[model samples]
Target chain A: MAELDLDSADGRREALRRMVTIRAFDQEAGNRFADGEIPGFVHLYIGEEAVGVGTCASLESDDYIASTHRGHGHCIAKGLDPKYMMAELYGKAEGYCNGKGGSMHIADVDAGMLGANGIVGAGPPLATGAALSIDYQDRDQVAVGFLGDGAVAQGQVHEAINLASTWDLPAIFVVENNHYGEGTPVEKQHNLDNLSDTAQAYDIPGVTVDGMDITAVAEAVAEARERARAGDGPTMVEAQTYRYRGHYEGDEEPYRDDEEVERWRDQDPIESFKDRLIERGELTQEEFDDLRAEIEASIDDAVEYAQETDAPEPSAAYEDMFVEQPPELERFANVARTDGGANGGDHR
Target chain B: MTAQAELEQETETMTVREAIRQGLREELERDEDVYLIGEDVGVFGGVLEVTGGLYEEFGEERVRDTPISEAGFMGAATGAAATGTRPVVELMFSDFMGVSMEQIMNQMAKMHYMFGGKAELPVTVRTTEGGGMGAASQHSGTVHTWIAHFPGLKAVAPGTAASAKGLTKAAIRSNDPVFVFENKMIYEQSGEVPTDEDYTVPIGEAAVEREGEDVTVVATQRLVGESLGVADSLEGDVSVEVIDPRSLYPLDTDTIVESVEKTGRLVVADESPLSYGTHAEIATRVQEEAFFSLDAPIQRVGTPDTHMPFSPPLEQEVLPGDDDVRAAIERIA
Candidate 1:
């Protein structure tokens, strides 16, 4: 594996930019979801931006990724247009999934962003499959599956890991150990303190990195990607992180102490990266302000674009339900007609 | 029959299992994207030898043999499907679906819908089902009805060699996840299957195996053969119409109802346990649709609601055979 130039001034500046983008996107989405501008459940990837940005920086457009419910950061990292993502959250016709998939299901196949799954531990199996495709098609592309500490308990994850090991799949399983599974800490849920131990059972190399450091995360992921490309099978990387927000938007802070949350916030990845850039004299205050303004303007444009986009047509609900409707559908139609209407009186 | 027709039939003599193998070989040759994956699918020749010689022809990658972990390979098939690869995974046995029910029900069945229809899963899971093979309770249960209960899945069971070959091809071509259930007992059953390499039997369509006017005998899976047998034995006395519903989920209820409407009576013969089986579902649907046309109450011929016994006599008593089907038809007629 090539040594990561994290010490470079340019690398520091880019890390700062990614953190800013992720923070801004999450904040905007959080507000939109709370205000009912966005539809469906939205799990903001607020405090854990470094993991997505750092790991994704090692990937290309052809490489695939399977994301968790907290997927905004992953989407941005994979180069999905913020405007279209916001539109998708807003349930607009121009959204990535044509408004059919809301916040929890945003996807762009062109970017190799397989949709963020609603089911825990679902992404690993999918990523494993995508890796199989890469192998079958004889491509150098690798697949990454993102999961939370909570998802590690899922049986499917174990199944996926076993298959990945057995077939020597070019895949990486990243577990963002954010200390909580919806307000319940990892200590209360799992027996083992370190999630990396799970990866060792599959005979794959497992490493733990500081999630708050973008440079460290990036270095780890870069090595994993190289190992995958060289046909060394799968790797498991556990990034120790903390979530600043409640499990969702409206939860009261009943699970932890205020001091702990404050301590984590003080070590925020974005602010730390910015400080590193400033100390190295790589980016001036004026340049930082300009980058901030540019990102804010782009975010504002995305919001405006989403707000102006139209909602999907009602007929879209019936369309694409099947690849090809069976002739026996006429029976359902007849049954529906006798029950008062073709939609069984609930056309809407 | 004409002398020319007799000679033509002689050339086409092949077992349902052989026809299925031929169909698989033809498909493998035609499409490079197609591949087979399952336990013992390679050198072991699939448990029943339905996939015999495929390993030698396609090599290890295409005719891959997987570990006993159904969930892992089944999930792999789903992933493979999403990536534009058509994988035909064998479940080894219908009863073993419990191991990978999550992949079959949640992922494979719901991917297209959950992904908002952006992707299509063109994967097929072929497995042996039903009793009469003497594989007993654990190995020989008929669980097609359990799969048919799911909405997104398409379940198929072909009785004849011709339909088996054609339907297997169709199931492979379908964009959705299709469960193809082959009867273990009918593997050696011979019939005149089409020699055409591209032939296909449409899914969710009912085949009128035998025509009659007195009563409709709706059957699926291995019971289709039993229904046909019952139809032949009652040829002189009672005219029994046999209807084979090849696919179960998108069931051809219309055809069954139409047949019931014509015959004014219905009897569904199923190899699964009598309680809450496909036979019950079909019987209820037929009665509901053609109630006014029915001359008698809809009846079902199926195994008593019990686990398949190991003993031959007990197994015979537990499973719905030709005698049971004949008795059911006679009562309805």
Candidate 2:
């Protein structure tokens, strides 16, 4: 039983829009990366869009979240501008982190979106600490750490959950169990059947939700948020979603069956949500097509903007190491200014 | 108290443990954001009782007791520091730092540099170091060299009661992440501590404990007191100058070089392993800065490259003793 406002026309439209936007954004990123226009490794979130959009639907604008490497959907769902994110993936200067943090390092701290960490199982502790700050300051906010199923086996993840639970910190841990911790299947890796069952060790509530349904995820997260705000401690919500694509863009995906991939595609989050909205009489076929086209045009503009933006100066690397750069950094920067860099030491 | 009266406040004899506890209490009272979190730091008053009365004075919120999970809470402290709060975490033994090295190196130390200076991580990690009580290799370690060798981490090890109080306060106030390596053996050693509420030993400064012109003895942690004792015993025989490099990472090389310049001889005694360790770094820097001023070769007194033995005789044989410092000075002087 989903408690989301699915009956409301505006709510349904917004959810449908978020899922569609993530699809448009990720597909464009995959294409650009394939065409060799984008630099660095790219992890696509095309298939598991519902887990991102739905969990975010229950959060306040000021509430914080930590994301994993495959984080474009989480960023998009958390209201990060696609133009800046896409530019970031393309390593353009106008990106969110000024091209300093490419795909895995993208962050918008002011938006309460703590960067997409390249290190797996790293986000849970950060989110737990953010919740500690919220609880210490007595703020009316909660934090969610979005991690992969693979992170379940990490010692830090267990510590994060135990700390949050013992202190009753305002944190919600949502494990996006996409059936594989990279190439290995969950069955081969874990002795337990359900990843959420690991939560019982911390003495907190745990649940498994249909990650393919946006409403189901939204309802579970909203309820967990309520429990956290009420000072009942943290809860673990395992979203049973699947990634139709490979782990990374060039993974070769020797891990799974083609039939299994096709099976997941049959339950594509975007197409299914779009049909639901049409069934609910919230939008006609023509209206739905118009919305899809608008999203495509917006994505096209992001690609154009990324291409137009200039690359960051090579010396931009030395600028952000510390608040006040130490003497060692200053000496190196001076050397780089007059030395063998591509910018010819003319940073000024 | 007025500035002159505050300066005139009586210096009291105290142990390093009490001095460190006073530092924690004053900082907790000074800022609401500062809290102490670690195992047995609350009702149990810490395993060694260095944080004994703090829990009673500050209550549960400020003086928190954590589970025996180093990586988890260390990572939590990093996150809290990046946000709005300042956290002071404790690792029971310096040897356990291996368990939490990932958080310490990657996140706590590198977050500011990686975020392009947009984030501030004002977190302090206080852990016990050294071996003298037969706590085996697993429990005893002087790992400050590894921490100091790492960039973005400021490290400190106070040799006396006053420096303990001062260094603890400085580590708490610093905007950067600092590691305070407290030697467990010196917890009971007594010295005069300044009674000022705001006194802080600035990081990267060295204290010339006993100034002499014949030989320079660079010491750290428990060896500082022992070196001073050695220098005293050699009073009329041979002149020995003892200098303590309180701050390890932002090392007080100028003070060290200046000492060697005057003495023309150098000897370093630290608790860590001798090879590729703190002593080596200091000795190499001394020679680089004052090679021409040297009268004899630089001498490093440290534990040989071996884990601390549990047996008393074996531990005594392996550990660098006060005699070691005297021998190094005698060889040069």
Candidate 3:
């Protein structure tokens, strides 16, 4: 319920910082993965940062959020420690999931981050349940599931929205229609042009936002949040965004032409937002440079921290499977301890 | 009030449906945080009538009727569980578990472990199992085996009215995710159930329905009653020890193993498919624990790896009954 007015200088500055920071973190992650410094397939949120940042800006810190594979921006926007997130991507012990969850599954439950799920259409139900929890507990906070356009066609998404609508739960569904789902374009994957239209099935208001414009996305999210808190049920916000990177770091991207990527790149949210901030005199050229430099330094610090952090002990894998580890698991744990860990345990 | 009158009130005979309904009512009244959420669970009093009269008593907020969105609501229950509220959800039919298996398997089963044991998924999923009502393959599946076999989930399929009430209460209170598979055919089956507020059949424990020394009949759900009837009919010919393993996941192998050790023979009767099922698990565990005590080859009574056919004749043909249990006991005896 707190204010996040981008019209204000402080709000605009904060938005710029988030966008710049996301760009820095993702670009670095992509580069490091190529350099073999970070393991696993990295889904860079280079261009779609505005959607996550702007949407999250409308949410309270206590509100819950579920994210997708391309989720670093969401995690950062939700106020998760970038150091831990970088450490997780680096497969270090200090990561949010204690290094058990890599890039695709980083979660901070205490911070109300349900998780960044690897499975498509998996988050909406979780967010819906969270909203149900809030309703049950009589809490004012809302839960948001930030899914990609690809997940729009998933049957569970329909079920989740329907449940939220029927229960009048305080949930929001944000579909980042980033022109493509994995290698295939959204147009090819979906029959409808606007993913928001799918909300009609749930009888909730659905809006399409210019994802390149932070203010528009923020406004839509703010409105949805208001509706949720007012017990008006769920709303769907479709952020028409574009991703600059491939689905993964090393993707060949054979499904699309370079021209299409270039066209989207020209409307890069961070750059466009920065230009608007400058024109409004809220951000000067030197201030923009300072913001970029500040974000870059912070990202460098996170990278260094991740590099220096230790990988989890091999035996830690045996833990966290149950609240009270069953006797069978205890036997396995004992063996793990005695055998100096399992196959490839010594390696990250 | 005299002690006998009060005791009679506590020991009033009720059907499995009434017992389960009582359990829900007691739990609902016991905890404000606990509520029911499922399709037609609220206003319709549940399609099976298991949750009959709960909506009128608790009102809409507690007795929520969900859209036909199992995955959504199941996941929502998981989410609600992780947060704070204890949600008693219904899947309507065990056969349709496939529709929500993603949530049931991944989110419900793995969340606590995946969340590094920070979460307590106090969610009770009640669904009807078994076939006899001519509902066919899509509606009538004794699929408790899948849940019982799945790690991190506590599965219970109660037989008698007492267990129906006890297990439901236990599941509502357990910190872990508990799947209660109710056989639709036994809703009318009557037994004396304890009306005591504190009564709860512990998870992972088995109850010996009848004591005998010739052979141990480890049955689950509806099979327990059928097996008990089998034991009654063959009283002069065979001495069958019927043990209902109320909870399946953290299976009370000790009870079954001890019973097999005493009887020196075993017949695992479950409504699920015969191959690689609850029967197999029970049989295997008993063999492992009491192999030397066995006097004969272990027999399993279950559906012969076929779906519950639509017609009454076909369903009866596939469905395991007292005769099958008696036959198994006759061989073991």
Greater-DockQ candidate between 1 and 3: 1
Considering summed lDDT, which 10 consecutive residues are worst modelled in model 2 chain B?
B1-10
Ten contiguous residues minimizing lDDT sum, candidate 1 chain A: A339-348
The candidate with the higher DockQ, 2 or 3, is: 3
Best by TM-score: 3
TM-score of chain A of 2: 0.94
Model 1 TM-score, all chains together: 0.92
lDDT of 1 by residue, B45-151 (tens): 89999999999988988898887878878888887788778899999998899988887887777667655677788888999988876888989888888778875
Q: What is the TM-score of chain A in candidate 1?
A: 0.92
Error of 2 at B81 (Å): 1.7
Off by over 4 Å in 2: A1-8, A90-94, A307-310, A331-348, B1-10
Q: Evaluate candidate 2 and give its CAPRI docking class based on DockQ.
A: acceptable
Interface-residue RMSD per candidate?
4.2, 5.6, 6.5
TM-score, per-candidate, Cα-based: 0.92, 0.92, 0.93
Q: lDDT by residue for model 2 over A112-166, one digit each (tens)?
A: 8877888889889989989999999999888898899998888899999999999
Go through the candidates in order and give each one's DockQ.
Answer: 0.43, 0.34, 0.35
**Candidate 1: segments with Cα more than 4 A from true spot:** A1-15, A328-348, B1-11, B134-136, B274-277, B284-289, B309-313
